[model samples]
Target: MTNFEEDISVYNFVSILGECFQNKASVNLVKHYPTGRMLAVKRFHLDKIWDNISIVQQEITLTKQLQHPNIITYYTSFVHGPEVFAVSPLQAFGSCKSLLDSHFNEGLPELAIILIFKDIIEAVNYLHKSGFIHRAIRASHILISASGKASLSGLHYACPLVINGRWQRAVHSFPLSTQPNLNWLSPELLEQNLKGYNEKSDIYSLGILCCELANGREPFADVDSTLMLVEKVRGCIPGLLDCTTLPSKCDDRECQGDCDIEISLSRRGFSQYLHEFCYMCLEREAKDRPSAAELLTHPVFTLVNKGISLPELLKPVLPLSDKVSPNKEMCHLDHVLHMSEMDMPSCDWDFPIS
Candidate 1:
């Protein structure tokens, strides 16, 4: 019997539900036959793992050690012949990127953005405390739940940001075979370096992600990766808020009057604070950037009204995703533009590497 069949026979797991990320890992919808508790079983084929066995083992090791409210829960994992299976609570709402594509195309509301980032910041802070850096932080890596809670995902690129309990600079020599989303990489990480980068690099990527959430797209996604690297090293920042629109009172699509102009001016001020928040995240100096813990308490996050829940914002659009196929081509080019055409085991998870 195949590894998958053996796992099913031993664990009594249900069938596959969906597949996501560039890795093509199957997200299986399973249930504990005894208790009927639902689960998301992620199956990674061992044959495909090949030489990356150590990385996969590390991913499982690191995931097992993490426990945070904003981080996805890693229930358990086991090897069944040639396959490894990780089980966690299924996020029915899918990824934040899928939400953006299906709904909220104009960008999330300021309050919603603040709440989501606050959760993400808390998760990143926890990771830093554990002495690791989530090298890749992006909208696609942030998964949302039916309850509207946002958790950080994509831990495959995770590595030690500190050594012997001391924060240290580490450099990575990117392999020509693999292409990453260069826009999210901090300037220091993109440079030819011997000193390398640290947890602060994750902070830089967080800043870019904030802009992405506010604008409903990855920043500088249209530029070629090589050119992006040069621009980043030159202290160029992504124009995250430049394209954002202010909340308007006009019910109609088209309106022209002194009242409309007055309304525009009044509403423009609403996003000013959010713009400043993004600016704080996009600071050119990594040292100048606030730590994840510090950013959690920023004034911008205070804008989230306790009375309003993020689920309300996601309710309308979440159901729309059920009708669409995950493999269906995204109509928006900007959403997937940063993703390379190459085929490799893509990794991004709030819990274990996906």
Candidate 2:
């Protein structure tokens, strides 16, 4: 038997869960041989770490330092022959993006959205205060538990925003080119003219992510990444509203003849506080955007008070079913095929959420 299979024998490989592109990690659901506890294991093939060892190492280092309710718990990591592994609690609900794609294809209830966003912003704020910048803040990086509590994941792109207790303005090197999905990146990152992006870049992504949650798809879905970069550089912004938020009827059809009735109605339909908060995050100029801490106080978050309870929040969304059957090999192959067909990018600026 191959060393990979030999090492993995300690656990019953139930199924494949997901991937971590930067670290060359494939998350798998496995049952511990000893206690029979099920866990998600992110296996990183060391063969791919020739020179990029630091990138994978950074994820392990940063994750070990993080301890928060909304951040994924890093259980343990160990090298096993040709590969390395980082184990964490299984997120039965999967990522927000996957869940949205599968179940809530039209977008979630506003209360649910607010609850998820609140947890995310709070986690991000904690990270920033602890001197880290979760450069990636997309929907795919947000993992939901069976209880419906959201936690941030995908920390491979994370880096320190502060140095020696002071916030730094620029980074010395460019991010890896293999990283895909530049559509969610901020203008500062795409332009590459600015010294470098900082924490504010994440807020911009958060704004886009909010729109994604509302629309059930990525923004600029029809545009090419290169063209999207041009528009962002040219000061163009995406509309936050989608069909779900717009009104079905327009009373005044005459005066609204030239005006976009849906757009007008959507504007009025959105929660004023939430809309304004999202607008603040999408500010073109990085400095104009509010920091994570400042955003926590926005009316959208503050007014929610005690949001939906975890049990209630999880009820509408069922846990991801185990597709595994008697033929384990076929189940694994099926998962690989399913993942390959997804339009989700290989790497899109991951920031820590859980």
Candidate 3:
């Protein structure tokens, strides 16, 4: 039997769901015959794993160690020849990216953004406490389960800040195979300097995510990446768009996507609390960024209604629980411009001899 057949026969896997993250992996819907429970099986084609098979091994190992409600639940895994399968709860609503593509093309309502990011930030806090840097955090990496819970996925790029019982102040190397996530990456990480970067890098990325959900597109996404990098290194900040921030017109589309705007000055029709929160996350200096724990208490998040329900917020677009079917048609990878095409600027850094 082929690896997939062997997997289906052994684990009762069924219904090939769809692909995600540039088609590098595919998600399968499986029903556990013993309990008749449903699960999401992520199959990784080892050949497509950028860094040998070790990274997939690292992902599985790290996922097993995590046990937060807002984090994806990893059940088990098995290596069938060159393919590795990771089983988890099926997120019927799919990824936040898919939601953006299907329902909220004009960007999610601010309240919805709050509810979603609340879960994401809490998940980040958990990882930070565990001494792990989630090097790749973005909209697409967040999946919404049948309960309307947003769980943080994409631990494949995560790494430890604690090395050999010592807490390392900085991580000199960037996570490999994160080319598609460059826009969401922190500037300090892109700088690739000797000083290296720390957990604050995640904060910067979080700020970018705030702008992404608020504006319906990633901040600075319309421009060439090299220019965006230069802009970021030079301290240009992206912010929330509104009637005030957007230019009168971009011919047909609104004039958007320049990273140079100041976040603090924006009165962009959005709540001031949220505006300040984004500003705090996008601080030019990494040290100026707040920790994940600190951000959880921000008034922007505190303002959310006590009775907030993601399922209630997302009514017309209900979960895919009614039936299992292919979702690749709406996975939203088309607009994800790959950074591998961009020429990377030279950086000076010392390579630690292993």
Instruction: Give every collision pair in model 1.
Output: 152-350, 153-349, 153-350, 154-348, 154-349, 155-349, 170-196, 171-196
Worst 10 residues of 3 by lDDT: 345-354
Indicate whether candidate 1 or candidate 3 has the larger lDDT: 3
User: What is the per-residue lDDT of model 2 for residues 84-197, given as tens digits with 9 covering 90 to 100?
Assistant: 777677777778887677766655556677888889998999988787777677788888777777898767677777778777866534456424546677888777775777
Q: How many residue pairs of model 2 clash at the backbone? A: 9
lDDT of 1 by residue, 1-354 (tens): 112222444343343444443464556555555454555677777777666767667766777688887877667777866677787766766667666666755467767788788888999999998888888788877877767788877776787766677766564644221255567888887785876677788888887887677666777767888888788888887644432443446566465563464354344333666777677777777788888888877788767778888877666655322443434433332232223233433222323454
Candidate that scores best on TM-score: 3
Clashes of each: 8, 9, 0
Lowest lDDT 10-residue stretch of candidate 2: 345-354
Listed in order, each prediction's TM-score against the native is 0.78, 0.78, 0.82
lDDT of model 1, residue 63: 73
* After superposition, candidate 3 runs with Cα above 4 Å error: 1-7, 10-14, 47-51, 247-268, 325-354
Q: What local distance difference test score does each model get?
A: 0.66, 0.69, 0.73
Looking at model 3, how many pairs of residues clash?
0
Candidate 3 lDDT, 1-354, residue by residue in tens? 112232544455554555553555666566665555666777676778655467667777888788999988667677776667777777888777777777865567788889988999999999999998887887777888878788888887887899999999999877777677889889899999998999999999899988888776788887788998999999999988875765533443332453224332233467888889999999999999999999989989877887978878776788865665445222322211122123332111000000
Top candidate (lDDT): 3
